[model samples]
Target: MESEQFRRSWPFTGVVLWMCLALPASAVAQDEGARLSALELLIRSPQLGGSDIPRDLPGPPGGVEVPLRADASTSSGAAMAGAQAVSATTLPDAPVRPSSGDASTPGLSEEMSPGGPEGSSALLSEAPRTGVSDGAPLTLLPESSPSRSFQVLPAVVAVVPGLLFHGLAPAIAGDGQTARRLFAMEGAGLGLIALGGVPIALTGASRRTIAPLYAVTLAGFSVFGISALANLYSVVSPTFDPGVPAATLPPLELEMGYQYVSDTSFDYDHFVSLGAVARLDSLKLEAVARLAPEDGNAQVRFGGAYRLLGAPEQRRGDTDGSSLDAELFGLYHRYPTEGFIVIGGDLGLRGRFAMSRVSPALAGSFAEASIGMSLQGYSYPGPVSDGNLHEQLLYSFGYGVWLGRGGPFKGEAMIFYDHRKDGFAGGLRTFGGGVVGNFGLRGRALLTETWGVAAEVAAGGALVGRLSLIYALGGES
Candidate 1:
């Protein structure tokens, strides 16, 4: 019984021994876990990964601390020492546990940490930072900036051509009637001109090309129309041609002449009479007062009519540009053609040069020079012989100027041609020119403009001349 009880107690004693030996392993295991936890904290913290920590490691097996870093290396000395220590233990044969120590002597770890090496490797495999933290791409704009007012390169395209039109319009208007019609035409055409500017202002377009085009078109349409109208109203009517003004009064001219073509081809015939032309038309009817010191000349013509544009219907856009004095006037001239009350059912080319110094400001009078052309057909020529004084050729062109410290009077110098053919009718050429310092005889003025009247005289071959009165009119401004 005693032996059996000792045997049973022996088993209990073995168990107790086993528990006692396991204490060291248990304590070491817990310490490792705590160490690993601290290592993980350091790894996760950005500050620890930078220059925050100091290196303080001891070599291998006998070392107290373990290396938690994934790339940690151990020394051979640490491994061998650990093996010898295990062999030296005189205890029963059992499995050896890991030292988990620094193992710097061997340059390796006793046991591999799960996922540690792989995780670190993956983190490094990622590409380095190329740009900002968010990591996105960049973009550039098409048009760099908003345009300035003068940056209209597109408008320039149309503007250039438009400018040309504006400058050349007056030179091409031909006559007063035509100029009036031009105003209407341009008013309509400008609608298109303005459109050219829109694209450049609102959309993508060449600043140099399209923008200029629009600008030029606007300039051309406006200036051309205005210049043509001005030229027209400055030449033929006795009343103020509300259309345009001579700015300053021109000089005065006076002359007369007579013609008779006893034959169509001979300068040898004997038929000559007196005639005069003191004004001409360019594009619209003009108002001019003139005097001819020749041909026993003296005449007066006035009406409430202001030199103005004909209604669209009256002018028929297709106006045969001709002088009022020489062209076959419209239905208005047919009631009994002649004088103020006589309806001159016909056409004739009347060219004249008249000027005066009745302008208050005459410094700008150099522009008073004028030239004109006309076409007229008469129903009857009572002065000659009623056989329908038909065919007419008329034109006037020249330079002139005027001056006045007093009133606004226009003075001018010009040459002209009048052609005609009928049964006893004749075609003659008149040469010579005369001057009249226009007196305040006709209703003419200019204010910011002024106006006045004057007479003219011309003598080419045949001593042809005229006697008449003329006037100028413009804005009170």
Candidate 2:
């Protein structure tokens, strides 16, 4: 009897222990279910219009019931009222979730609902939004939209049409100011060409008019070349500064050199040449002489020029101005081997016009025109011919350039026509000979502060070339 009672009590004890273990597990499961339900309610509340909670919703393993909210009726009522207000004020384009039974709303999709499986996938796959405001859509441009490249068409225009059109390239590039200036330059060039070309054609290239006509022709071509270069430069480098300061010459300068004459009629071949100039305010005095040491052939000229119009000496800085001058000169020449001597005086007026203001490349360049009358007396040896006054007309038109600034290495050059037929070659013409003309070029280069070289050449009755070493006594070097 005692053993049976102990067995019965053991069974009961084991049953009670199993019940205690099962109770705690059921409570833990209930707590987990409650938390999960709360989270689902929070997520779906806004999209669902805060409707009543479903009674048949499944719970955890313990079958516990969890309230959607502590004050479900009041909270749901307030949330429903807020939802109504939002629906009335929201933008028409805003996305909306589809209701299971409602068919009146447009643009509503079940996939957009918070509780739908597709909604989460769509959110994950959506592209990132630009930071632009919804009212204004963003505009996009290419990455290289602002990049620039040089165009070959402009260069072609500059070289082809540019030669004759002057400013066509700049005009095509939309630079009106440069175009106008280039056009004006072209017009001037064309005018000069006409001025030079017409006379040469009319003269039939006669030697009597060849010298001055060639000088004019050369000047016209110079203007044309400058215009062409300017056109190309304007197109290629629109922003370049093309300016050179006006150069000033000093009060006095002296030069000496050697000369070589290549005259078929003269016996002298080599000469010593000397020249000097003195400036006194508006008056300039000049002297030049050449002697052939071997043959005793010699020539000397002394002259002065008085400024008559335009800027004064003190205003030499105005390089782009005009000037008029009155000139007077006396000359003496002897040809011992040829047995003759000549003495003469000339009076003339000179006009100078500067063109640098029109083109930078033409800086320090000037056009000059002179006209004069030379009264001369000729004497021959052995009393064979009597001395008589002869009248000769003198005239020239040419161009000159100051090569550099008034510095150590400055220089100048001139090309001119000499119309006076009064030398030994003139004597040949005087005796039933052909008409004559002379073309001459003279240049000087200062190699140092006080030392330089000089050269001159004349072609007409004779071809003469002179080279000399020069020393500057007083100047603005």
Candidate 3:
């Protein structure tokens, strides 16, 4: 009788919870429309809303991103720091450094991003960027790059181990049951996944390519989180209420969506449910001088979307977009060469949504942004034979190389670490990268440039295939 009652009310409760969660998204969407309008209008008539904007809004920040807020000048430092503290909770981890039009260079990842307000970093040296040319030997200057202020990923990796050993240190020391022991570890893991991407983001700058592996690692982090939460609920039957992020301290962006990832494994010859992504994009506001945005720009945005697919999602179909949440890799760029050799590794952040959606391009490469939630489970498909996947906020971070450059015959070889349990996974966490080869029908001329087809195939993990598609989305006209 209890089970039957739960079955009936379970859905009702879930629906109510969903509706409540969606409120923020709706409100944020409205805000995005308003901002877009205001910006559009401002672009047309600067006098209209410019006067309405708070005079206190920090003027657009300038110069390179600083790692530590202490080094920041005036209140902008503290304001940006405060903003990061608040935004950190609402922001979704994004690996977008590698997604721009001009980011044609090979290997150099824009993963280690800026901290609050383009803060400083311990791993880098402060230096301005005017010389990004290839032959220049790519100096290791932190001040000149965006990685300084945008890298909030350490939380994902550090939290799990730290919390498990620290937060529950007392509980573990006591004579507790196996459940308590595992729960402590699980709790720590989830906590880390939730915060791992923070530091990386806080310190990220706009100079390098943001790799997918970093945020992808969040997937593994989520796995442990979901498991911990699920177990805790099962044992304690805790209330479904969760904490709201600090940014939305007073009012937050509510969002919701459904996304999925389906893959066909050729080697194992089986179709599997990779997972889905459902998330919100938190909006942000930054101020920079008008003289040169690239030189100094402040920005803020909010939004959220469902994960259409995971890992090999791009091969399936493109995903949607949201105005909330700061756009993760907002930097623009161009690749130096057509092809080059890069060496790196791919790490899996357990069940973190990896779905990539390629869009119609304006030129040679796919230029667009990704929006969706970080799925702790496979949101794409229904409960599979593997059982229910836990839900949590998680991201993955890993190191790897972009071999053979961006053009055809582009290959990526990376060593992947599955931080889901941090125990390290082999097959379940795909390591060997895929291949995207473009075979031009004619020469690289009028016909070929204007019209061509490309075939992409990835063999590893849960997906294996040889998919081909024609290219012509605003190409050379």
Positional deviation of residue 148's Cα in model 1 after best superposition, in angstroms = 41
Residue-level error in angstroms, candidate 3, position 233: 47
Give Cα distance to truth, residue 430, candidate 3, Å.
Answer: 12
Q: Which runs of model 2 end up more than 4 angstroms from their true locations?
A: 1-247, 310-315, 358-361, 381-387, 423-436
For each candidate, the alpha-carbon lDDT, in order, equals 0.30, 0.60, 0.27
Q: Which ten residues in a row have the lowest lDDT in candidate 1?
A: 435-444
Candidate 1 residue lDDT tens string, 127-205: 2322324322111111223321222322232234434332223223223343344344455547655665566556555
Q: Which candidate has the highest lDDT of all?
A: 2
Q: Model 3, range 1-477, lDDT digits (tens) per residue?
A: 154458889889987666555433222111133334323433332133221211111111322222222222324343344333322222224332321111221211234333522322322224333355422221322222231121223223224543343223223323144235445546565556556455456557122322343444344364454333322222221122211111111111121111111234111222111111222222222211111122221111212222323312122212221111222211121111212111111212122221111111101111112222232222223445543343222233222222222222222222232222211011343234522211111111112322322222332233323222223232222
* Structural similarity to truth (TM-score) of each candidate: 0.21, 0.49, 0.18
Q: What is the lDDT of residue 322 in candidate 3?
A: 12
On TM-score, who's better, 2 or 3? 2
Q: Candidate 2 vs candidate 3: which has greater lDDT? A: 2
RMSD of 2: 33.5
Q: What order do you get sorting by lDDT, best first?
A: 2, 1, 3
Please list the residue runs of candidate 3 whose C-alpha ends up more than 4 Å from where it truly belongs after superposition. Answer: 1-373, 376-389, 392-463
**Which TM-score value belongs to model 2?**
0.49
